[model samples]
Target chain A: MSPRQKRQLSLEVNGEPYELLVEPHWLLVDVLRDQLHLTGTKIGCGIGVCGACTVLVDGQAVSSCLALAVDAHGKAVTTIEGLAREGRLHPIQQAFIACGGFQCGFCTPGMIMGAKELLDRNPAPTEEEIRAGLSGNLCRCTGYVKIIESVQVAVRLLQEEMAGEAGAPVSPGPGRHAAVGSGQGGAR
Target chain B: MALWPFDYLEPTSPEECFALMAEHGSEAKLLAGGTALMQFLKQGLARPRALINLKRLPGLGGIEVGPEGALRLGALATHRRIEDAPLVRERWPMLAEMLQLVASPRIRNMATIGGNLCHGDANEDPPPLLLALDASVRVISRVGERLLPVDGLFTDFYETALKPGELLAEVRVPPLPPRSGAVYLKFAPKSRQDFATVGAAAFVRLADAGRCVELRLGLAGVAPTPVRARKVEAALQGQLLSEPLVREAAALVEDEIDPVGDIRGSAGYKREMAKLFLRRAVAEALRRAGAAGPGPT
Candidate 1:
């Protein structure tokens, strides 16, 4: 039996209001995946060594595994599931799918979430910033080449969208043959 | 991983935090950003009875520019806030560079500058640079407030001057003198998350004719705590800015520091690396002062 008190936790995750009875000690990652069934927020190395549990808390990326659920009260949380809208994927999400950003996919949610944060803060981050932005996250399967390509594509897509390039269809390129939902290793 | 069970208090005012500290003193841990503190709890290194959340406190997160171009950085200022500040980038580019190299974006977002300074981990990079800048810390408690020189903040290995009931309030950094430049350089093997094996920060002020007027040298991962190479500082105080002077000052650093061997690197390797970093950092700082200010690139 877990000796923890239940608290009324009110949070806005993915632009939706959620009021759940959460244990005071429960991590935000647990609340998102276990209670809310938002499995897109995966947990890896619960001690914060791995950035697989990254999520946007109030538009800033934080390691949800280390963040207590109670601390997220009155805050906004965004997970991988929140990246798409109206049957259309967010440009970054689409770019990741197109650009072979993930190989094993265990680290995809975190990679995308971390990328989302960088683009939000600095729309046109340099190559060094992208390397530094995703430094906390470790992807053993795909060398960072395709991941870097994915971010570059997203930058162009998001930039076009910002400049009123609405409904621009993502074209095929080096990212065209990326496997979707297969979770296999990308090109060596 | 769930946090260990503990009572929580979110105090919006300093008085409430003080009162809680007085009541729970050693039993409670004040949490700011919860980056390092939460990691401690999760690892079972600490099991405080209560957690006093400092996030709700007002007036603890602002960065104010004082008269004489001093910077008064609040304890709760996040690394992101400090790294991107126009004043910090313009006046203290070393701080900006160090912040950019610290951890990563996700960690930097939730980690506080005060928390990083307070942690005092040898492998960490900020404390040494701050000490080189001659910064002072403002600590508050139920009793009153006290200002401690950054050099005096760290006592022994992994220990600081902070008492049980007191909290670090702010860090006051005086403006750098003209003709002076500072640089922080660290060597981390493998990826960026790895702790540094050797780190050096140098602040050098040159004379009108390009001679060294003043010098402050700080080294990390080369001592139990981040420390100033006082012997090296004394050697280069009045010397001309040259390769020979830099080599002399760098040679003195190896004698002043006593680093212990660990998985990061051998003690001898650390010493040699320290010398290399010191020489490079001093040369770069002097060159910056000689040029027409450090231009943006």
Candidate 2:
């Protein structure tokens, strides 16, 4: 009978603290895209069936469309826009580009976010684990072969970075060398 | 599309939650993981005047083993937690395996077990397995707390037996009986994320002579609510384990189910698959029990 009231939400996004008044019914994806202007998080099949709205809430991949902005009041939220740091892309992002993981780019952000969470938990996941981790994300293009390869390449790049072999900014150019990409030629 | 506007209430304790529920009653919807409720809200299926957020409720989220070796799963435990929990995996691997097959990694991370149960969706994977395992849920309100068997939790389509002001706090799963085994088999012809056309779970305890000492069967997606196939169980219980006996008992599942036609399958198709899965689940459970060694008494 009464009008819905906005609630105060205080949370951290991309390492920045924010305090805003949001409607109680506003989904986290809307708040991220509209309120914060972080449109990198895409919303597909808003009913949580599609993983196009994946984001990290407290380092765990969750469907932002299913989470109310109020539910994220005290948590650290990471959108796909936050994956890069200091003008350099995250390894997963670089891997997605190098491995041709995206064709339409509609599902790329969510796929990369999901892959980030997967690698964060299990740095060196097997192929089956990679597929299982990205099972929630559906890519209408690329047929998932390159997406799986991208995650595998990301793992090797991360392992190389950890070993201090290639600390330089990973070039997004073609023919960039990946340890795992060596033996599998023309697969990209 | 935006969700319909609603006021929000965040209650930090069970007493506060119960008070809010008592005041708001049917006008309020309690939110745990928000995976199921959020979809309902977005689709205009539910228009609660107030959304009660239960994230801050203390002692409502955790997995612990009770003194008697029973597993106590807090209502707020996510499917991801259940799938990865060492205690659940070691004690009730069937439950963990079932949880692993739910939706996907993201949905599993966001969907809570309590919310899943309270949603009372027959297409879900956990209810039938929980029913077959003889699990019970603890429902608490300001007045008192009571235990309801998981089999009795679902009353109808998208309806639960939880009364107004009553909240499901935790699920208590009894430890598997000695020489007993359980299996949950889901038949999803579509993608892995799709709901099962006919999901079946079976628990069997074998006697030393390979006779079935006990058998419990539960099915989902073939009825308005998850149901225990009592007729099938009765046919198999205390009988000598055999291929023909299992097949005959499983065939009784067709008569026990009341399926509805949907995109997954026709009612008749689901009924047939229910019988097929029931047979496989019972046979696998019997084989596993035999491998577990001598039965208790």
Off by over 4 Å in 2: A165-188, B291-297
Which candidate has the highest DockQ of all?
2
lDDT of 2 by residue, B98-201 (tens): 99789988999889999999999999999999999999999998889999999889999999999888999999999998889999998987888889999999
Q: Which fraction of the native contacts appears in each prediction?
A: 0.76, 0.85
Best by lDDT: 2
Candidate 1 accuracy as TM-score: 0.92
Interface RMSD of 1: 1.6
TM-score of chain B of each: 0.94, 0.96
Number of clashes found in candidate 2: 0
Instruction: For model 1, state the Cα shift of residue B69 in Å.
Output: 2.5
Report the TM-score for the A-chain of model 2: 0.89
